[model samples]
Target: MNRLALLAAASALVLPVALSAQSPADPIFSPAAVRAHVEFLADDLLAGRDTGSEGHEIAARYVASQFDGLGLKPAGDAGANGVSWFQRIGFQKTEFGQTPATLTVSGAGEAKRFTHAGDVLVGLNAAEPHLDVTAPLVFVGYGLENKRLGLDDYAGLDVKGKIVVTLRGYPKGLPSEEGAHLSATKGKIAEAHGAIGMLSFGTLQSMKARPWARMVQMADEPDFTWVSPEGVPFEAAPGLRASAALNDSAAQALFAGAPTTIAAIRKTADKAGGKPKGFALKTSVTIRADSVSQRVTSPNVVAILPGSDPKLKDEYVVLSAHLDHIGVSPAKAGDPADKDRINNGALDNGAGIATMLEVARAMAQSPDKPRRSIIFLASTGEEKGLLGADYYARHPSVPIKQIVGNVDLDMPLLLYPFTDVIAFGANHSTLGPIVAKAVAPMGVKLSPDPMPQETIFVRSDHYMFVKQGVPAVFLATGYANGGEKAWGDFLGGAYHHPGDDMNQKIDWDAGARFAQANYRITRAMADGDTPPLWFAQDFFGDLFAPDAPKAPK
Candidate 1:
């Protein structure tokens, strides 16, 4: 009877300790706190938080203050770097206002006037007015220049000092056979040919069938970028414009009285059957752009949790999340009243920021401190071309060689009651094995990338670290075959839209559990002695030396 009583006492003693370990991480991720931050960030008061805008300044300051309150060390020296954790990036913001743009073809019947902000686009092609081109027009099929394909769009034509109108992507299929044969990289060839202005035809019949067309094309609104194709930095290149869908239709109308449609002409070229005939339609286009240059400040909020082990503490594990969004879109396209002006970006990234915040707190309070430094980075300007993360990768507060893993969070949705986390780039790094080993008992399946062509591995801020030889993981909710509509409903509604508001729809309890999971996973990595390495056959294997040690099979 006495021994039985002792056994019962032992059982009672362990129960409280076990329950404490498995208890919910609610204290770390208070719904009130998460909602407060999300609501403030998504609020219209920030005025769409465009980079270099007043709203952007307010957001940056708020983030920096949070980092300060967290007692983070100044990652960048203020006087030496002329920036706080708040890194100031240099960029030119050009404002193009709508005025009247007149286009008159000498041979065409009438002069057409396109009002600024309505029917036409105007922007500075270069630093000066010398980029203005008033020349004859030449239509180039896809603007591809490749010797391997035995076809150069600029082959029998001189585009110098002329306006070159080019079609969009080449037809699908292999380089061999009747399929369209063109270099995958063709943007450089367009600029090299001395085409004063190149207008990309966006609306083709095939493009309409693409599932991602809706995401890429904002209806009725023209998206403009001075960005050149990769490998072709025209340092002094002239104006580059992506024509509206209407512009493509207008170009097609030019061959109206011809015997063949543009589509048929391209098909003929693909088969190498004959030279598709070209017609000269009197074409004249004028673009005026107002360019504004300004100096702006955004921040990368970083807090470090010093490790228990002295040696390993010098090395680090980074947790990153972009704190910027597309800001806001103009109202002319849809819902003129709201003006598409508020891009609250609740899911695109607001969730990511909140995750990092909770993870920081939870890991800090854990019973066992990590062996290596844990860095929580709130990066800025990810929407503006991954500028903040790129800068952090180049100018790291910690030694680049010492950073073992980069855990970058972007999109986080409600967790499935019984499913694995979807980690892209898992197979791309040596850290994958460690992660796999940790989640094994959790029933979390390590998945190889199902959508490789999307190049999602290289899309987020994590790519910046991976490119620099740091092993990284970009985690998102696992994909379920039956959840298409639910996925679409969540993403399509709030993604870069004004309706992305903070509401009860978000599963805060699940979000907190996910954050706890992240904290545990990262802690497991940081507390270990072995640092993760670049995986073999991961495309970036060359980033490590050829003789480098490989991850265990």
Candidate 2:
């Protein structure tokens, strides 16, 4: 009766095959752990967790301590022996001091003082004792000074301490043969001309993609603090620099008042096929700036689970998630959502951090460790143009060559039940197929990137590794599975807004499953014999071609 009864009970419980486990001994990802991590990281107490703030520091310490508790080896700074896990990455912070800036223009016998915050704007250049400029204004076409192209806007004349005014954007289309020869390039070319300040026309419209522009705007207001990239501590010649975009009407008025406008100057320069006699304007801007500079330190949390194989243990697999967010948003618009204020960044990255932790925990419980090392990096300042990852890639604890694959987990909140995963850089690299093979048995379909026009492949933290010739891939929810409303609801409401708070509306259970799938993929790469690679069609494919091979299942 005992054997018969036990057999009968087993048969009854396992009748349906789809519900049974693949292997009883296999390690399964723990959803409870992932939820716990996410809840804490996305908590209101974190205060939206903006980088370079006290809130950001608190999050960094928590992550570092977690790495320490994981019993993972240090893989940060490098010494004579090998490498350490903790590296000191510091940046010099700049503050626009309380010095008021004033702009004065004496045209038509009118001398008026312009306010810096409202009427005028200025930034720092070289750190000199002072920036006194009375040089004549020369209208340089985009200010390109490429020696290779035989185009030097300042070839005939001097612009060392002068003010240069330039047009914005690449012209409507390809330039004429003569125009191309002059090498009128991007905006950065204008800054290299040794001009005290540049008045940029029609360029501010493109500032939507620039963090510096946005930060400057916020700094003008009294309620919020602006955080910029850490410069090299102090400029060798820090001076007052002011730039502005003159509207069409404004440009017309300036041209009419000056000896020559940008149009007439360009016409003359083009006719000579070189720098023509320059025209000067009777305009001077008096910029009195108050600014401060200081050194700031931040850390990238690194924890590693060493591999078991004698041959491949030295190689590495990186699982990364940015621990930092945009932090608190200033309350404007007088709406309740704006008052919500905290850009808690639940989906932007708290989800990725929790997923990485869950994956690490699951692998730690496995019967066998991965063949190659698994490194978990909670990088900082991702919203600040991937600064932390960029810094780490250049100063990697392990040899960049030993890194086979990098899986960056970002924005995994809205998972679909039946749809394929939106795998980025799939076509750009061979890792796409490897990912597909790993998820196939789980009955999950893989989908090509649906929003190619967005050029999302170049965005996110993974791109940093990719830039260093490593194969990196990231997955996010796709709009193909859900209706327009569902897609819009998630992105439109919480993408980066204050409404991205921790509410029960998030499908945590589904998110946990997605995290588990990523864990399995990471495990496969970590233990496999072959490394992932960029596809032949990808722009970076040649960089890793020598080591590229079919990833082992």
Candidate 3:
């Protein structure tokens, strides 16, 4: 049967009255229901639900309609109707011009010239339309400076008025989120140390996970950021004059006369936990780049289900999922035999949003109402640097303090029958115990992140909430019952590809189970008297919410 027919059949079997009377313990997550939602959202007609596109607007309307049917009050920006189901977010899109970026290395040997998008990938500085820099090169290992962890790649080196070259990533054993947080500050760190330009290359392990060709392909895409009403783009790194990423060949050229090869440095850093030594290169580097910018607006679908307890109704627990995907790839042309070019992100995020929809349905229909309000947010522009979530965090519809916690669902690969789950950010808050309690009866085990090197924790929508001091967790199917191989295969073959369509195999039962687990976790958070708290000395809590109350000693 088709997805719509299967949904109709399932709905016919369950009477409306029975559904309304169903308890939280009863199985309300129907595989057929979930499949119907996924198939529709992931359909080719949606054009991969690209942010700000007509298809994305259609998906947003669909989500708003579902919220309306569930009796969820519109909690978004106010409109002519007094309330809207969408929190409109404005963005600044910056696309680098076709003017080929130029990079030249000179020293004791002949200077080599590298073309843009060929041997090096140069990033445009939106703050400046043009950039030109010439400085001596200095290797700064991972370019990380963390006083808390006593890691300083520039401890004994002086990079003043020079270009800093660094590899990507932090120490191997640090929490994945912490590593990500530190790595994100590399540019700022370089700027602080008087560096004028920055050159970065992926480590061998990192390059193996995501190839250089993929990175180069993404370099041409327009970079996006939520902008102010005055049309000012949010400046993430203020002082950097020039920045570029080098492929293996370009990196070798940069290190032509150096004593150690890039391979040797990568192997040493891998074995010693990202502690490679820093040294002044015998070569000097120069760079030039150009770019153009435009402004656009997108919507973040928002709704709320009020709590039964009058006193606690003001507090909220957020359930979030990104509705945006990579969208249609211009690089892939469709053939006459099979003209399918849309990404159709069935697993990357169609599964996540569908799961959120089911969870919302269950919460709305349950006889026992939660003590705290539940907010459903289908965010946009997550595929573009978490723009929607970051915007919401900065300009929340409600008071930021009233948001007690967040549970984010993103890309729960359900190709196999998963018996375990990996909950990123679970270790730093009370939400961890709540998840453990909620999933015990379901015969599902909560496991640590299987691929921490990828820094999965800070790569999703939930990290925005964490940055705003709200405790949060991102859930994913763990490596159990052959799930590891399934996940690896998907990441290698279909991730961000047009092949992640409805034609791919999926275990609907597993998807339903995953949704049910999330529903229970959300229910527990809403029904509990106490709100989730950050553990004592937690790095995120200390950094983001220093004055907030800590967990019990």
Candidate 4:
């Protein structure tokens, strides 16, 4: 009962009515509101709030109770128990068996075998629990294919009945977001080309940027995927039954007798404007996969602010934030006596949920509501490949077509006094101008993406909505006014670490302004005469909503 009151007062207080000249123009948003929520959510009591765990359930219920207090309508599933604020989603967890999957490269004098957890990191096949497949190897520069872009990494090579060896990432010169989208379609393109297996390795540049040691640590974690209504996990290419990501030693051994050595490819990948052509390797590879699968479930807390206007009430705007983080870690061999193993994700997502709650409260308290209905979604399993958002997009409580736009709040680094902001995917749709106009009054500048090489356009929960033909924008504090160093320090040190707790020097002032900017953007989209639309010639717009009307950006 005491915790419930804490949840209710999470947005009540932290600072005075106003802080400085750079503070939000509106007094409704307060640093106190953002601080209280972060403090409670990131507290050690939640135990990191992993998906499907009791900690995360408490987090979901807290959001649901907050929605109830705001007088928002339940926007989830209908059952014999009546309507509820949770859209539950089922999931499947596939753990690789004790076999310790092996990948063997043959035809280079003698066959060489690489074992999982040592030379290779391989996930379960899911479709065929125990898989032993062998096929010829083909080197496809980046394994990318696009007709409009005049790029065909598999130009004249026939990859049918073969395993494709691809260099990680796309060409360096293409548009960042569009390039990212295409880079992510490697599996889809491989399946379309009739490939039966895949092997990928990081470029030297990428390996240097993000050390292979980090990848090794991450490989220890299990993988998760959402289950379909058909009771199967979603596999982009079910036919590509065997796949693995290789490290330097394994990659070098696999390219023993190839036309172009892996070292040459690595050098080419390091240089800008460098591209390699496709060629069949003088080798064949075999992969072994054995997996154990289990069923699990989680919920997406949903609530709706019904529009006041009858004509535009059907059109909806979604404001979403994830509520899950990596759970407590197992003790390492050489750990400190008093180690903090829990991964309390304060800025990673607790800040996002807090900001969204404040926005919902502001709209509910206002006498004048937007013309279009607003859906506040507290998603689950986002840290596990954006599963919750993907599920909600696939099985929306309301008609999917009625969802006009999405504003996703993920990790907003509020550790510095931010003067500008970066809104990913904004340029691809009309939502860009709306956000710019919305934040201009608050002395906040909308800056362009600085780390384009990271390819963050499709990393967060909003990408799911974009894939479902909805125009979406993901907002975060920009790399300005000490933000660059703050982001760098966070990503390098505390991200996903036990150190991401409430003890960090977080700037609540910046959080209040960020919340206000996002509120204005969402409010403007909901109240506008016309709903947000995709750009006339954008890649994502053409790919997802070919028949829908597109406005010039």
lDDT leader: 4
The residue-by-residue lDDT of candidate 4 on 362-466, one tens digit each, is 888877888899999999999989999999999897999999999999999989989998988888999999899888888889998888777677999999999
Regions more than 4 Å wrong, model 4: 1-16, 19-27, 269-273
CA-only RMSD, every prediction: 9.7, 9.6, 3.2, 2.3
What is the C-alpha lDDT profile of model 3 across 1-553, one tens digit per residue? 1353344234225432222223456556777777777877787777888888887887888889888888989988997779999998888888887687889888848888888888898877777777777889999999998788878899889999889999977766666789889888899899999998899888876687678887877768888888865667776666778888998877888888898889889888777465788898999888987888887888999999999999999999999999989888874444564666789898889899989988999888888888999999999999999889988888787899999999999999989988888889888888888888878778888888888778887889999999999999998888999999999899889999988988888998888888888888898899898889998899888888888887952
Poorest stretch of ten by lDDT in candidate 4: 18-27
Give a tens-digit lDDT track for model 2, residues 70-118.
5677677667976555555675445555666444554535555555545
TM-scores, each model vs. reference: 0.70, 0.69, 0.91, 0.95
lDDT of each: 0.57, 0.61, 0.85, 0.86
Error of 4 at 479 (Å): 1.3
Per-prediction backbone clash count: 6, 15, 0, 2
Candidates sorted by lDDT, descending order? 4, 3, 2, 1
Q: Which stretches of candidate 2 lie over 4 Å from their true place?
A: 1-26, 77-86, 99-289, 330-339, 415-418, 452-454, 483-487, 541-553
Clashing pairs in 1: 94-292, 122-288, 122-289, 123-288, 123-289, 331-339
lDDT of candidate model 4 versus the reference = 0.86
How far is 135's C-alpha from truth in model 3 (Å)? 3.0
